[model samples]
Target: MRADRLVSLVLLLRRHGRMTADRLARELEVSTSTVLRDIEALSTAGVPVYAERGRHGGYALLPGFRTELTGLNHDETLALLSAGPGRGERAFGLGPALASALRKVVDALPDAHLATASDASRRLLVEPETDLLSRWPVTEDVPATTMAEVRSAVLTGRRLRLLYAATGETARWRTVDPVGVVTVRDRAYLLALRSGADRTYRMSRVLAAESLPDPAERPDEVDLDRLWRDRCARFLADGHLTVLVRVDPTRRDDLLNTAVAVRTEQPGPDGWPRLELTYQDAWHAEWALWQLGPHAEALSPPSLRTALHTRATTLANRYG
Candidate 1:
């Protein structure tokens, strides 16, 4: 609490240049005696803080005093401010005291930047229901500080201690060599190689992590893009096999625009546009048929056509 008060006093003085003792006491919600004591403590800690007497004086940082983040450019400054208190606290490993300190830095920005940042904050709202977040299981909140550190290690190719919770297993710690971090939709993942292996783990499933000492023998250079592509291909291969569909002429535009890949479009016997869509599997094809309703139908693959008919029968039975 004392440390927090001291940090707040410093920030206030830095932002306002000077303030009366009474005003400081009021802002900090402490007695004037507490403010005076804090001022002494900050001075003792090498902060160039001083008091002045008379109508114009309270407390001030000595001229030329600057904080650690004084060199950030305008855009960087806005980004820091936009990240808000939650991210700032986590990114810098600061608790409440550090949050108070960052507020001063944000407050000290030029008026124009401050206004712009404020306006942006009001206009930009990040809705929480993104696809990745929706799909991810609720486990525990990942601290911002940990995520930032993990990201740093990933970029630097450093080994890290990861506390991972595998599906159907208790969380256990492991030392991993982090390769990178990836974001799919709203979910965050740490792509890391296990200490002795070539595979990488997702960060979301990771419970906790710590950086490790650099290895003596470096692993072979990894082509991250190639690895990602291969992983995706494998995942798709495991899904349902391909199926084709035909779209009605009235819905041809929607099919052409919405389908993953529309292979062909031509008039069928009834003057409807037959859209050939190569689906990843039967389930997907059936789902598409349901979405299209009577506007499209499965054209080939007798098995899928039969499945669709069966699904329609089931639906009719339920209603009947």
Candidate 2:
């Protein structure tokens, strides 16, 4: 409990600079006496924390007080930063500003940390098969100022007014209580409550989003991960058209990794792997078969195999 309070005290001072004992007590859900004792403990730890009394007074950290991360050696600090791509304009939509801030943070690191980070950068490289940079449409720029406001509203339990466009549709404005935001496959989505139902809209589809004054009652519980997974499962199940396929053992992993649903793998008489993969949709199966080339053979659901063969024949005709 004391350890938690001490961490809370440091974090509070870091964020708010100065807070009154009453404020700290309310935030930590502890009594004023407990907060005072925690303050004493922090002072003993050489934290340079102090408090002012009476009107216009509160707990404050001495000017220029800095917390040095002594435990994390230089290499460790650098490795941490280098381990993940810096969250950039794509996530924050701040363009050059985010890059500038990231540069500053990385540059300010100690020499050891800097070296470790440099080494890690060289050692580890992640290249997505398809470049998302090209897919992101720069023309649909939601104002950075408004985007920040929406993000804040989501964090602080507020509502937002969203101007959105569905695929092949004109933009329309609607009021939604912000629930959460999800980044899936490098695409940004806003999860919100609309018309008594939970909904998700692509951030790219949102032409504009502004925080609104009207605040809806926050839900008692928001299991966003579960909710999103359920939505995805339902969507996939509804879209899927069951198709049985026989996949060569050599290409089994490839098919398993693809976007197909409910795959069952078994060995054939020749000890080769055979797979029955359900395609969420006919179009997807047709596309997948074409991609699989010779490694996959359609086995069941006569209509699907017929369609695949027809397409393959058509392709052969065109190519030949």
Candidate 3:
């Protein structure tokens, strides 16, 4: 796994002080190019690692750098292990590997702290995938091979070709310069540039991905979090159909899951909660409200009200 390899790379550097790219590659059993890419990723992630240019020059961690978690006290270890890997690892197809890594870490803990940390980890409970309402967690199924290709492309800074199935569009081929991958709420997205334009593709929507040999054209440094936020803002700002809804407070979460964004939320005059929601279009707005049945009422955009009323009347007359 890349995570394990990265950790091993750091440990190798820390132990050996300095090592050439070829030496590291042989140790890690990966190509020299792959070792170089890993070093770049580590540097970008704020690890105090730097390269030297002379013949004796190689990759090295800054002096006195330590990647030790053994210093963690019992409580700290418990908290770390208790939280576990969760769905994020599964989303990235690293569940088993992460679980193994955690076990290794626990095993490496001091003998005095080991038993206590293990027992404590078992005692603490993380939230279940299903909630009290029996709503199952959203699990996007991105093929393992597809995810691997995309991940490799991002890690290696290579260009990518994707067979993407975009929302409301037919599946098509696209070429992009991959920047990074981000997982939010169990959904993975590939953040990349398509012809110098920002493009984000949901990992599940990528039917297939090919890592091209050509290097990706991208800035040396990236602010992935900021870029993701900016893209999200632009997406939410475009062609959204605003909806004002009065809904049963208990069903608010259900309503939220279906909407694009929640603009404003307050108590309604009728003793219910009022929410200003946005959807992709009028149809989406109407459908989301309808799903809640009488628990939700659309209060604006005459057209949506009429559409719902017409549907209700049609159903009512047929059932009557």
Candidate 4:
């Protein structure tokens, strides 16, 4: 961690030239003492750095001393400079590191293209910090300590004792073999084996966690994407309740996109589209179709129709 901070410090100086210890500390989110120690470390490591004493003096590196890093082609340089203020980096606690890396990308560019590239990048916008019309973004919360412990367990191939709070169930501890951690749509999940069965646990629902001593018996090599796909396929296949439905022609894509699957499609007598679909259960079918409202109608399996009608009546009565 100190090494990483040291590298970031060097990159900062390389990018922005001489900066006060106070400024560096603020940029790196550390104390002035830490920045001083890092500067001493860099000097000890043979970095050509020096201190200046004056009313407007601070730390500076030897002119032209740059960290030899990845050389970006023209397009890559533009892409790096045009990237969003990454909210995803906050999810993994890499926000500062990402910023440092982006700085390095700019610092590493050839001088001939530097000004023009930097100027052109300013023309592009990707989710600016504030806009007059846009709402502020809210990311999901997972306690930092809990996420760090979970991250350590998954990275080290260790088992975890999870105090997970399942829906409507009392908080209970389970020992799970860590397979991987995934952040989907800003929500983090742990894909693991609990009692030799695949399970997915939302990181937010984990009340507490502790790493186990024993190494998890995870495969030496894993393709996490493939494993996730297999898990998803099995989950969908297990959702056995099938229904026949008719949807307005214009909303066919909307229905298909929102619904889990459309197993079959045809045209009905009125020339609207008809579809056969599957769902996890009756509640799943009822709720999913109910959200579509009048655009789609559950045609058959009589039970689904009755369930929808009952729900509509209940809503009407409540509103009345």
Per lDDT, the best of the predicted structures is 3
- Ranked candidates (lDDT, high to low): 3, 4, 2, 1
Return the TM-score for candidate 2, rounded to 2 decimals.
Answer: 0.63
Candidate 3 C-alpha lDDT tens digits along 1-320:
78778888998998898899999999999999999899999999889999898989998999988766355566668877887755645756677777887888887888878888878778777767889889888878888888889888888999999999898999999899999888888889999999999898998899988999999999879999999999988888888898899999888889999999888999888889988888999999988999999999999988999999999999999999
Which pairs clash inside model 4? none
Worst 10 residues of 1 by lDDT: 85-94
- lDDT-wise, the better of 1 and 3 is 3
Return whichever of 1 and 4 wins on lDDT: 4
User: Residue by residue across 139-195, what tens digits does model 1's lDDT show?
Assistant: 334676677678667667677777888878999988777765555433566655664
lDDT of 4 by residue, 1-320 (tens): 67667778888888888899999999999999999989998898899889989998999999977676455566667777776354556565456677888877777777888888788788887755655536454457888788889989999999899999998999999999999888765678889997778998989899999998899977778899998888767767884678899998877765765566677888899988889987878988888788789989998889999999999999999999
Q: TM-score winner among the candidates?
A: 3
Residue 41 Cα positional deviation in candidate 2, in Å, after optimal superposition: 12
Q: Rate the local accuracy (lDDT) of all candidates.
A: 0.67, 0.73, 0.88, 0.82
TM-scores, each model vs. reference: 0.46, 0.63, 0.73, 0.60
Higher-TM-score candidate among 2 and 4?
Answer: 2
Report how far residue 314 has shifted in candidate 4, in Å.
9.5
The alpha-carbon root-mean-square deviation between model 1 and the true structure, to one decimal in Å, is 16.0
| Clashes per candidate (backbone, < 3 Å) | 4, 2, 0, 0
Candidate 1, residue 85: CA error in Å?
A: 9.0
lDDT score at residue 199, model 3, on the 0-100 scale? 90
